[model samples]
Target: MLGRRHLLGTTAGAIATTSLLDRTRAWAQQQPFQPEPGATLRFLRWSRFLEAEDRATTENIRAFSEATGVPVRIDSVWQDDVLPQLSVAAGIGNGPDLAWTLHSTPHLFADKVLDLTDVADYIGGKYGGWYPLIEQYGKRDGRWIGISNLVIGVLPVYRVSAAREAGFDSFPTDSDGFLRLCAGLKRIGKPAGFAFGRAPSDGNSFCHWLLWSQGGRLVDENNAVALNSPETLRAVEYARELASHFIPGTIAWNDASNNSAFLAGQVSLTNNAVSIYGKARADGMAMADDIAYANWPVGPVGVPTELHLVYPFIGFRYSRYPNATKALLTFMLEGPQYERVLQSSAGYVSQALHAYDDSPVWRSDPHITVFRDVAARGRPLSYAGALGTQAATAFSEGIVADMFAEAIGGQVSPREAVARAERRALRIYRS
Candidate 1:
């Protein structure tokens, strides 16, 4: 795996030599792919939260079509609905030729996706290399089944004034301090909140952080079910306590609920991508200046255990225009096209490639810089175990999120919640 140090330490001479060799190999092997005649493509992606991002994507598609003569039709759905749509497509073998979907989608549909190793190789060689964590989502058994596209940094978004009113001069860096801050915010009548429902991104992001930050794992390094442990119980118990300081009805919150609540001044704190802050500033809300960002508090694990939203572009094996799809993806990842999307995202979406780390958009604002290292520091959805069908199944089924929700909602004790989750996870991993 390529760590941050290795990525940063790569010398300019090495990159130039590697790029030359890659170009030579492509020429010798007649690679870089060519679109078949009369080929057209269809692409599906999650709906964009930022207008700039949406416009940039449309512009890129138009540019690709103009350059390659391969007309592309793009469609979008809500983030939570993307996986189900892709599943249906895979089952019927007649959906979009390519999709940009979130974590575990590639693993869940590994057998149905086309191999893109050549595409990945060319892109990574030309633009430094992919981040270490990105490989976990894009590759299956050393075969490239997907291209890791975007890393949505999921961190703490809070009101600066409200935090000061709650007696915090700065955001907390540890779980204990975080709990105190939450309690203080509650006392001031501006409580913190996090999604507990079946929100595909926000719910899983925070709950997984809660579990893993406490040194808990759903599976061991050997992939055995390991959810029933003191660490898990502690995490669940902490979640319960944290929930007491939350706004009412967070249990039913979807992916967009917290953003709505925060902007409406109903919640002082929440965990989300930078979209909340972006929206606030875009619409000129009064609270825009009061908004600030912070990384997740470190728990007993003594490190960052964040699980950001990762979007990977997967191509279905059933597509007749496989070559066109590959070529289009390659076009999108090139420096000019990729930088357009990155600058437009305003740090809402981070790049998975190491070369883009020097993008000026990251430093465009002080609050945005906190998200720059997310792709390097964040963990994959499947932590402490290999990512596969079992891990994907367990996460999509909301096993960990449900465990926290049940305990927080008073339906079960923390220990019982842990036990129930263990049974469900065991059933998945054992199969």
Candidate 2:
């Protein structure tokens, strides 16, 4: 479609761009960061992100290293690897300067983290203000012990074509409708999926939203155990019925299984991060256009309740490079560098800063536009309550996921499952 001269010019332009990027990386890597007499910044981050975004992060970190003379070392680990690594590090009071993890790891180790109130306050004052949920996720008592980094949009990804065949022309808008739809889906080979195992993130997130949307909560705003209640009873009963339509082996599924299930067309519906949909589009997979994302179905409460697994970076109290660590986080979260991270992620990563909610990534794709406002909506793990030692302990213990799993397993009655969960919660709270 191009003339020889035009093709040559385009090739030259790409070559020049590559050359410039290579030079930039070389310069950044060469320049040593030594902000002060004794300064070093080490980051432990999840290796998984949009590939280009991870590259951008590495480059940005190198630039930070160059600018501050603080040799920044980024140790990338899998999401699953992060928490255990952080736990051991916190237990010993020694680890990477910035411990990156999801859920309530920060709150679980708040006592071992350096107070970052200044970091939080400065960012809040400069960028309008911190989101209400970000404060709860990052703060300990009254001090900010962690830097809430970003959110990955978690919502329902379903096959529209399959839904149509299942005798539904539109997505379910509420829990009861959702139940009937799943039942219909089961009539066909395709089944709705919300992981039923102790499989952590996806399972817990969906079950919690299921409970919360039904006017149930693990704890109230007052930090009281709200797991055992009439609302929870109804939720569990609803969940038990819904689980009947789940795909086989959902009970043993880890996070990746759902993605595969959705892609393989074995599932008509599933709760997943944008990653699932993003991957389909990126890879030009067969099922790409057939997929659509939707909000969590509403419930009797008439409010949309959703849970997102948030990865917040916390500076350990034992870090000798606390100041540098704080600066690194602040740098990543602000200005052009932050925007670059968001842009390169291609709608996969959402920001805590409300101003950044207008990120163009979601707008890039029509189907994914649902994720644009998700950052402002989804609640953290400790939602409907506080992120504290008790709540963190319960989440880390996987008791909540177990509760829902128990209800669906039908080995125990829904009431018994909640009672068991309540007993665990009371023990956690009392401890």
Candidate 3:
């Protein structure tokens, strides 16, 4: 299995072979061309959501088989399982024809991944409504290395009922109201007013979004470490205060624990990604109905709520059947099949605005609306050659979880943590 860190490199040779075939076809264009048959396509997908015997993934695979009359096989695995599988693929050439994983982590696969710039031009030329931020997120060194058919946004997941019970009729649209909402939740015996997990990745998501909303930049347009600024410190201080109201257990919580606590109804508010809604529905948890989402609240600076995003897709880099791959990707993007996947998987929202036009998930779900709005305004996660990965690691490891544990757990001040994060990040950048 390939680790997420190196999954992209897993099928490098195969991509080369596929690119060779594409070039061969290009050279043969002057001759009368006949469609080739018996070309099998394989895909590595997030198996849990769509691969179960009767699930959306399974059905989508079936539909792909029918739509193209080409046999499509998928090696399904859990999202977390992909890294380990890719680790194996890196050693043994047994991975699928295409992989669907996080766009941020695709750098791990950059060497082996196909540059989809031409494919993106094709998709955009035809669809003309793909997520702009996602297109940017999928690129590395000015070439499209991945495609994000789905978009995820970070936001505040709140207990609407709890807020109303606490005498707030509407969700807060700004930062002060958010703090006040937390305070009010505390007054009503929700000891844990809001909670976010202590994973460096989770922290990176929160920190970047906070900075973006406050008119702060992790790196300027020029790409330098900007984590030590007064603006950033203010964001950290505000986060520290919010951490103070987190459930006592968050000190030890990683990604799962925080979501578990939120799921268990121990917390009233959580600033998290939109993926939670799907998880909530899958579990059929009682709190699911009570859960509603809001834009990452505006800061004092009047920046709207921001979200750290994840973009995902299946690319044609290793496809023996480009037409088939294009057909499948296009089908998933253009119709109800795509919506079914998004709704059932509780995955990220589609990057397409028209996707919202016909979606019950967009129209009927409160959380979905906030997520959609954030998508409309948000930028992709910041990346600068190696800086994005390094910063993500630093923020995830040094600042997010560990620092919160130290500061809110009575070991240090938030200021100290931010300074430490800056020093550590600078070292990583310099190194």
Candidate 4:
């Protein structure tokens, strides 16, 4: 029952005889670690991930199933639900072999996830090396707790036509210019929304950008409570100013809100994944032509800083088939499967591995090419600090996002918001 499933597959004879599967299997065998193909792989994926951009991964799942004779069940839930379900599974010590987890999960649940150091090292060595943020998200302490597959490379999705309308022929590349850009957009009734509220995809990712770009950090080198610095106060004040210019209801937006705002012609700019573009292209929406992307404005600190949306693949410690799980992940990351997935997602998914950096998908579109550098330029929320239980807890509770919301909502001063956030950060760090 262990390793016999592939051989006992109903279509084993036919699938086994295919040249691609045969060669892939032989490649699997040559590896120092090979797991017996399991009967089934129960997977829980983020529902947001299954959108049109998810075609490559969705397709490869079928292909992997046929290639390995392993039946895979993929349960798609929203990004918010993924964490709760994963927490329950980890708590009860029983769940899918692999669950879609967020950036800090590998560190937060280090004890509950299967170690994939060997697999990570193998893949990293073969692929160009893993990027910095991948190391922070997937490797906790000294072990690799999960396999990071993609960075939801987020950047400003703006209306090129709107920029021109605002008297700018090109997107601004610095903070001062960005400030003016948003103000101009607001004057034109095309106020940009940055979701100072708790937008999982937009606000969550951008908060770190605002902070880091302004030379502020959640924690210092010692991973202590460092959220109340002067730079952070400036970031909060900047957020407040930006909020005044954002479309109304930004404080309450979720991941989908900004996408809706942009598609509806309500926003001039906002940070997001490529899903908006993918959906527009799919429907041949007229707004698609006006849409364009730009990297973040350089902050006082230096390089293009951002909080990359990192989604990881976690194998539960309760799994009966880690080897099979490893095989599936490895196969998925391999050139043939991964490239298809990236293409299917329409550049919404950027690989953590540098090896795939040359993907042609980036070149296919004039607007999307900026994303090729987004992943490389981004970092996790706990920038300059380790991603662990403390930071994960803080981020999950939306402490940072709420701080901006409160300040922007005019419910609290920027200083007051930073102070409140500081206290919360201390508790989480010391927890």
Q: In TM-score terms, which candidate is top?
A: 4
Selected candidate, larger lDDT, 2 vs 3? 2
**Stretches of model 2 off by over 4 angstroms after superposition:** 1-34
TM-score of model 3 (CA atoms):
0.77
What lDDT would each prediction earn against the true structure? 0.87, 0.79, 0.60, 0.80
Q: For candidate 3, what's the RMSD?
A: 9.7
Root-mean-square deviation of each candidate, in angstroms? 8.7, 4.2, 9.7, 6.0
1-431 in candidate 4: lDDT tens per residue? 54667667746646534654555656565655456644578888877664554655665666667766777888988777888888888899888888877778767678988898878888888889889778877887788888878888888888888888988899988887898889999999888987777776688888878888888888998997888899999898887777777789988888888888888888879988887887888899988888888888997887888877888888887888887788778777777667766776667778788987888888888768878776688877777788877777888788888888888888888899999988888887886
Tens digit per residue, CA lDDT, model 3, 305-391: 354556466453444555556555555554455556666544355445444544666666555766555556666555323424554
Q: What TM-scores do the predictions have?
A: 0.89, 0.89, 0.77, 0.90
Best by lDDT: 1
- The CA lDDT at 135 in model 3 is 62
lDDT of 3 at 279: 78
Runs with alpha carbons beyond 4 Å of true place in candidate 1: 1-31
Residue 166, candidate 2: how far off, in angstroms?
3.3
Model 2 residue 174 lDDT?
88
The pairs that clash in candidate 1 are none
Going through the candidates in the order shown, the clash numbers are 0, 4, 18, 2
lDDT of 2 by residue, 1-431 (tens): 78999999999867745654554455444422223546876789988667878887787777666656678878999877988898899888777998677767787787788898988887778776877767778777889887776777778889999899998898888888999889988998788888977667688878888788888888888888888999999988888888888876677788888988888877879988778877888799988888888888889999778777677878888988777777777777765667777777776777788777676765788787777666567776766778777877888788778888887877799999999999999998877
lDDT by residue for model 1 over 178-202, one digit each (tens)? 9999999999999999998778778
Show where candidate 4 strays beyond 4 Å. 1-31, 37-40, 52-55
Stretch of 10 with least lDDT, candidate 4: 13-22
**Candidate 2 lDDT trough over 10 residues, lowest sum:** 27-36
Query: Candidate 1 at 199: error in angstroms?
Result: 2.5
> What is the alpha-carbon lDDT for the whole of candidate 3?
0.60
